[model samples]
Target: MRQPENLIEINYAANQSSVDVDELGMRDMQRRVFAEKDAQYLLVKAPPASGKSRALMFVALDKLFHQGINKIIIAVPERSIGASFASTALVQHGFFADWEIEDRNNLCTPGGDSGKVDAFLRFLEGDDTVLVCTHATLRFAMAKLPASAFDDTLVAIDEFHHVSADKDSSRLGQVVHEIMSGSSAHVVAMTGSYFRGDSVPVLMPEDEEKFTPVTFNYYDQLNGYKHLKSLGIGHHFYQGRYTDAIHEVFDPDLKTLIHIPSVNSSESTKDKIEEVNRILDLIGTFEGKDESGIMRLRTPDGRVLRVADLVDDSDLMARSNLLGYLGQVAAKDKDAVDVIIALGMAKEGFDWPFAEHALTVGHRSSLTEVIQIIGRVTRDAQGKPRAQFTNLIAEPAADADEVTTAVNTMLKAITASLLMEQVLAPNFNFKPKEPGEAPEPGTLAVKGLKAPPTDRVRQIIETDLNDLKATILQDPGFRRAAAGQLDAEVANKVLIPKILRERYPDLNSAEAESLRQHVVVDSVVKAGEVKEVGDKKFVMLAKKYVDLDKLDINLIDKVNPFQRAFEVLSKSVDPKTLRVVMDAIAETRIEVTAEEAVLMYPKLREFQRMEGRVPSIRSKDPHEKRLAEILLFLRRAKASQAKVNA
Candidate 1:
């Protein structure tokens, strides 16, 4: 593959090389969560590498030694993360005790009982301080033991984002809810990113308020890094397959970990052998093996890269053997393997300290996934002063609406996240989007501020985004509008302004409206819905009018970032059929109080009685729940009012 003429490169300023030293006796965020002595339920919202795992150890140990806790169960999402609780040297780091875990208790190992009910039961009978297992194992324990058996025990859920606050969640969520309701157990919930982009709260507000929150920020972690200087995140689009675009974005000289797209992706041949061959052939064929049996590839740039193929390819034995050697490596040797090519590996909790870049070939599956993949490169390495994450997403040739919508929606989400990251980093300032000069979608640039953000500014932005993202996940009108497809008046005027006012009660109508416009502009531009004119750049909102400046909230054009993307998604679904779905979504967002929703319910049922069916076709949508809640609230309210009158 020849290098494409267009090569997009973006660089960001480095963060400070060191952080403020913490006082002895407590880790960074642990001090707050630990100090909440009156609280039984604790929620720790911290960033990755902020010592959250150790914080859990400290809390769990306190529960056992001081509180009335007999057994402790630590549940993680995956097997690899189980190692987080494995016998760490916490005592040496100024803790009361070491996290002592029996080797046998780590039940996520291969052939071991990942559903380790018997092991949990046995541990309960005896005296085991901590039993580390996967989420699957925790579910099995709940099934085997009586709910009463959980009494006097402390259950800590790590990666707490997986536990949906709503009833629609899986066992991980159901298990925690049951533990809270049915048992007298203490719960400590921890997550690197507490706000799930999916909109389902990990715990309902009523449940969440009971827990004391220990929070950390991105600004804190990055500003205090020991070795890392700066971080860059970029998204590059190609004409066809990502493999062809690899040369356009990937820098072979940088120590990188390449995650080959899944077999389902256009870049993957669905055959591992062919993928490896293509990667090697694109870079350079091996001239020969090195002294230590490392596969040396002389790239087109003429630099030799010690490539380690984690996937089983034509050189199966050699690739497999090199992987074994990497596993035993205690510390990074700068002279070691230069690249790691993996398929379904090296993603979460897999540490390769020397890695300088984490490059991928697709729009990440979820916002959480994008965070985790970027985490792979952000870790500080000895000689590496800066790190980067490159997302080489495939841009299919413009064809029908369905494909285009999927691509654009994905691009929108990716760019929004990237923008958020830079804002939260060391110093960031996003100039209000001026009307005539919008940056083209997928065009790369880094914006930084000279002055650092005050703690107040960081808190406000975080609160605004956290609230906005939650609405994006759950609210039909807002979600659709944010995607820039739903061109409803309420979303632009009523819905968004109302939210901003609520987040900042002090803001007047004018201030709130101005804030709302800037937000909409951010969404529109980042979602890849803008185009360049002769000299001015115009955002493609309604009729495609060139904008003069960023502060004009009331624009001459109708704005829906997803408007174009929605057109693409709409091509697949019949326009008539989509009207039915949209109607249901709007009707369900009933926005009534307990009394109003309840009163609305029987009315809803009567309407259904006349109409012969529920409003929505999708069984799992939130509006379904809202419908029932409204009816119940209305009936109960009337009944109580009758009682009061009597």
Candidate 2:
């Protein structure tokens, strides 16, 4: 039987502030971006379904009519997302102007790139004010037209994380660089997740610094929602085929979207179409396909389910018909589709507002993809008070050669949870405690928390905190540290700063330290508990309760930022399976370096004095065992030197 490991469950206030409209008909996130409508290079980092598309429309219209911009070019990652930037009636909602686009201006319809590019070029030369196209079309158009052709245009890229800083591989990135470098064009970049999977940055440091950022985190979007009050992210572990255990987590009552594993992934059955059929059989008795190709299933309880099958691609015409029907029906009626099972089509920019659950099989290697999939079910809807995301993974077998891979996948899943917790929690404002001064209502005053000393550091801390944490959590060194292979302080002080310097080479030493401290503070604080006791609030720092007034950076540095992940793993997984995971990690433990030996030598002497003998590898304490490993490492090095001398 597969059991769910509900790692993090967050409850929001649901104050209905996010959806509240202002006089200009803008939601919270849109209002924030529209305030900075004058920025030539603006980046909006908000969650999905937070009115980001309309925010772009608001800003693009302002630029086109008032900001001296001649034309607007909105490019999306795919044709499906192009629908987001369609014509709008802003004046009906209290704005000064209305957004209108001719039918021929939207190049996202079924068309070839060559033709779209030609249409794009024609629009650029004509008197039209706005045109929508796919990113590929923009790339193709840029190849033929010089950058000067877009001198007075506003280029807005949706799902902007797809544009990487690597000029060698990403033609869209090259197109952006060319346009910005050779012409005086206003650019807007928007994305749900700012970080990428491969750790390659989305933009160069210099180029990123030029943009003014508007960061509306997940907390703001969810906490201010009118309907969604809570969200839960969990993992379900199955020993054998995932299909055999799908019923354990698949709840037919909840509106759901299921993403089957990719064909190349380890958990995949290698035949997606057959897998879809098998899932349908497991759900209920399959009746037959409807006129629009939707799979109809009759459950044991005598209820019929309308399931959309996107994995079957053998018949293009039938699939097109199914897609067209889904697009039209999903918008108007909540009961039009009961379930949507897709392989790779419905992950990004697929809007299903009534979906209450997003179930995924197999570990998604990309955190961005995971976030996007989670976004599909997070939209606020009537009668939907909660959203849930569950990842179904295969448990490691004792005799399997790929046990290491399985363990890595599990650790990545855990880290992704940790990152999501940071994303979903409310923002913290940590300030230095002053003598006889009272803290603000929602702020924390610490004795030794270092304030950001530079504006550059401050900006990064304010806007790029989650992105910075994402980079750190994905680092190989941090992964080892999270697995208990390295000391906590070393991870906090050494490895973290090294990563920051590499990520932002322009930061001075002081700025880097400040940024590193902010990261540690934010992660540790979010992972711990905060409770109110009478007039004083107490925070749990490394299992000990400390007054919020006395909390300091030194106290925070001693605790591992990832301690909660390990603790959650211990409680979530069975003892035997956890032992398997730990043993697999131990097999590939990092060797003790000389610098680490220097750090551990004092602990080694202290252990000798206390135990009246050398530390033993069989000890129950992890640190004591670590000292023993260091001793063995030194002995081996001495022996190797002796052999060389001989």
Candidate 3:
């Protein structure tokens, strides 16, 4: 068959005119990306409807026609998707005639015909044609082709996550490693998101000396939805179960969109048919145009019908005729919304720019799949954006918790994809925002920003300590220690000595000697179960002589001094000596209120709270939870200080 002249003309026109390339949109960053010579691979990860494919299409076309490259290969997971991509690119560039696009199932080589294996080899041998196929096809092709065949070729792979290594088997991983190893081909790999550690090896194998680290960037536009809403061109979501709530929240002027998922199973098909018939009946009630310029109902139900069903004599044909008749009804009825029913055939490659709302009412496999379905409504038109409201009728049995996780995961994946493309691809760029399009002052730009540092590890330890302290201080027995038993020891051992030293540093030698004599009763140290001779120990005579009524003391002085001493001693003291001193200190007596008990002990507070009682210091696990309680008390004290300053 001779090549079509119109295809040739279109190709020639595309090469001569800059329309398609210009329409690719945004050039600044893409030009900067192309300038880098050291970059080994380009990774593009973009959200659905973010113009990733369009940008790539222009770049690929330019490189093929303008650059010296002889071959350009585009590979993806699905054959139909690949063909659709190639066809769109060719049609946009007017290059349809010069390309022989084929799926893996129907490929031909000059020598051996019909197998993708042979045909890919033929293309690799400087055949000067573009090859668009699946990743599996390329893998087989690579196995047959010699290493030299990769020279100067641009290889693009879409949906790259599918080729990632399975945890159980490394077969796909090894294949990717081999293909990328020592190849001179300029490669571009695209994916929504990559597993944390899985991406580096697949795209840039360590064994390959020429590999470069992957780069990323992101694009998120709030303007798209805003523009669509302003134009009043699309449907808005009405909460399916709470329609009144939706009405209360949203303006009545907005159009409503109802989304119904496919009921593809045999049993559900009957229900789906009935649902479509009911929607058709609803359309009959409108007198003229409703809030949405012209109301429309779209369902999926055409593939099951034959191409000749439009003119068939059977009753099935009459039902099949509903779509055309409905389209006519929409044209005739001034107030009517367009109603469409497609049988599993309307989703892929379908673009309805006017669609403003999408209501999802069924199960979905992945977040990416759901986004793709929703993306059908989010296209940009003449500076106006598409799609506003997305209403999902969540089934109670569909495991909403898991669905939420998957959706979040998918969104992250989309963000990661855009980031990769922005940072890595040389010929990719985003347009500068027009005046007044930037964020308002003081508003945070969270999307596409680098992550802030997390202090979670430190916080976890501190929180655990605080909790423990709160529990321990709530015991009645613990409260006794808090009251005043340690007060005498703390005053004699720590407070009086420190204060006396600080205030009267110039005391005469004779007075100091007299004071020391009065304070010390003996010089003796004891070993385990043994009385040692001539070892030094001090007993304060001031403890007996000083009048307790003359000195004012606070509870903090007693508790804090002992706590500090215990902390200091624990570090240097032998375990046996530490246990002896701890046992003696544990016998000390103090009094505490119920509030003070809970405030001082975290475990006690927790126990009280758990038992529906006020937190108390008198708890059984006083020692075990003392640390948390003390910490909590200290925190509250600090907070009080802050408030006083304020």
Candidate 4:
């Protein structure tokens, strides 16, 4: 078996005149072709709308006429996908211009006109022909082909994962492994889902480290957020049970694509009919008068049909009506809302940019399947940021917890994979950020935080404190204790004092008292209490006051002023004098009635605003401020407004 000469300076543009290099899909294909050239095998993994088929079609032409390498085989998991590719090559890419493509179904060759299997093998060994067939045919041909048959051939496998895991010995995997060991040939395996670490060994032999995995998880590489925003794609996420909450978020202006799995074979046909009626009912309510109100349905039978003109009781005639409606929609209003109600069949290969929302009701546990469903809604296109909304509908019987866990894990994996590729991939060619495009101020400030030796221990304590605060805040009885009204004795005896001691263990009784005095002042000032502490007082004049703002509130809150005099003297302060100041504040309890609670609500809002917290208040009716104001006014206002004049 002789090695074929490398076809250098191949004029891809000259051979394929119809191929548009500037198209997003074509440019993506070119990147894969170059990256894969150095490997013994290459895998192209992409999602539904990522244009995997179109990429393969262009690559096929470049390999055949442009590269002038005659013996090339294009294999697909299903006969339909293969036929579809062949049709596109002939009609769209002009591949059938000067050459005839032979299918495995009918062929007669030098092997004495044997079965279609034998004839296909002989055709591959013969001159200038491209073989397009299914995995079954490819396996059969490979098993019967002579040792010299694949010496210079290139095998392109579509939906390659099916071959690696499917029932029969995957013809593509088997042949590629055999050829790499015995002959010199390049194998390209393409699929939307390429589970790399697990599928690699089966797809390529263990010894063959010459495998390059190229993935275009559209959301990761395409910067879908920025791209979609540029195209005016508005993202709407409705977080609740799908069936109940999804309808509320539906925008009649945008076309919707719904993916719902059929229950079973018997129920699928019935479900399609019901789905058509529902779509018609919704579209009829549209205020605007346009042909855009059309509904197109893609059935399980692989036929894409429309829902217009179908009589309510028509049986098989409904299928034809669907087909007619689809034809009109595809031809005339291509960008119209395409409401697709499908089972899991459309998960991988379907791509419709006009679909702005996807509602999935399918019961699939595979991460790949879930990713594919989400991918359908994230496709990049020109008009209206293709499918900016995704709604997942769970079956009644589904375990909500298990489903959420699985979906979250899958999402994390997608996000991590995207980040890794962006930051680590060698040949990654994303544009460098412009000067103005850099992150906003303080964005990367935390990158300078040097970890302390006790960082982990400190984190645990902080987390515990946060959790405790949340629990306390949520308790109805605890919330009734307005700002200064919380029983300090109970707090001091319980976890609050313990946590404070843990955070400030060095504070002695007198120093702790000074800290508590400051906490009172800070809290009072925050509550709009503008009373001033006299400067001539001993406590206020301690060394003309060491900056009180720098004092630890936790340490201050636990002080016993009578225990030590120099504890205040350690800071050049007189304990007896400071006690008077502290006692004065203590005597003025400033009772925090429910009315005071209401008055203090605005301070909470102001604190939240200053701290950059999410504004939870949406309106004044349910607003915390309003609630506080109403409650306080009722408690403190004049009797005329408060009392009923019965």
State every prediction's TM-score relative to the real structure: 0.67, 0.96, 0.42, 0.46
Task: Please give, for residues 514-543, the per-residue lDDT of candidate 1 as tens digits.
Answer: 455545545544443346667555555456
Candidate-wise lDDT, in order: 0.61, 0.87, 0.37, 0.41
**Per-model root-mean-square deviation over C-alphas:** 12.2, 2.0, 25.5, 22.7
Candidate that beats the other on TM-score, 1 or 2, i.e. the better one = 2
What is candidate 3's local distance difference test score? 0.37
- Alpha carbon lDDT at 399, candidate 4: 30
Q: 1-646 in candidate 2: lDDT tens per residue?
A: 6474578899999999999999999999999999999999999999999999999999998998898999999999889888888888999989988889998999999977889989998998899989999999999899888999999899999999898899886888888888888899999999999999877888889888989999999999999998999999998888778888999999999998999999998899898888987899977998888798877799889999989999888999999998888887875589888899998888789888999999999888888898999899889999999999998888777787888888888778778888998899999887778889977888888777778998889999999988988888888765457666566777788778878988999998888888888899888888888899998878799789888778889999888898776776677678888778777876766677777787678878888998899988776565676788889998998999999999
> Model 4 over residues 1-646: C-alpha lDDT tens digits?
1111211111111222122344333454445654455454666765554556666655555566655456777776654355445534334433333334644433222123236576566676577457766666777776776545776667777776565522254556656666667766667777665432221224432422355666654333344233243112211222333334445544455555555445452112345556545554544443232343244445444433432322233554554445344444542464444455554454555545445565554333343454555555555444644344333322211233343333232222222222222111112111112334444332211121222234332322222222222222222222212222233323332323333343344545443333323323222122121233563211221123322222333332333211111121112213442233233323333334443354445655675577575333232221343333334454565565557653
- The candidate 3 region of ten consecutive residues with least summed lDDT is 520-529
1-646 per-residue lDDT for model 3 (tens digits): 1111110000011121111133224333333233432344655544344444544555565666766556677776655355335444245434322334444323321123236666667666645557776667776776666655776777777765455444244444445555556566666665543322221223322322243223222123223222332211111112123222222322222222344445552113345545544444433332333332233322232111111111112465454344333334432442343223344433433334444444343333333343444454444433333334332222111223343332222222222222222222122111212334554342212122212123321221211111112122222232223322232333333333333233224444443322322221110000001122354222212222222112112211222211322322344334544343343434443323334444345544565567775433444343533433444565777799999999
Pairs that collide, model 4 = 305-322, 305-323, 306-322, 306-323, 306-326, 513-559, 515-556, 516-556, 566-569
Q: Give candidate 4's TM-score.
A: 0.46
Distance (Å) between predicted and true CA of 110, model 3? 20
TM-score computed on alpha carbons, candidate 3: 0.42
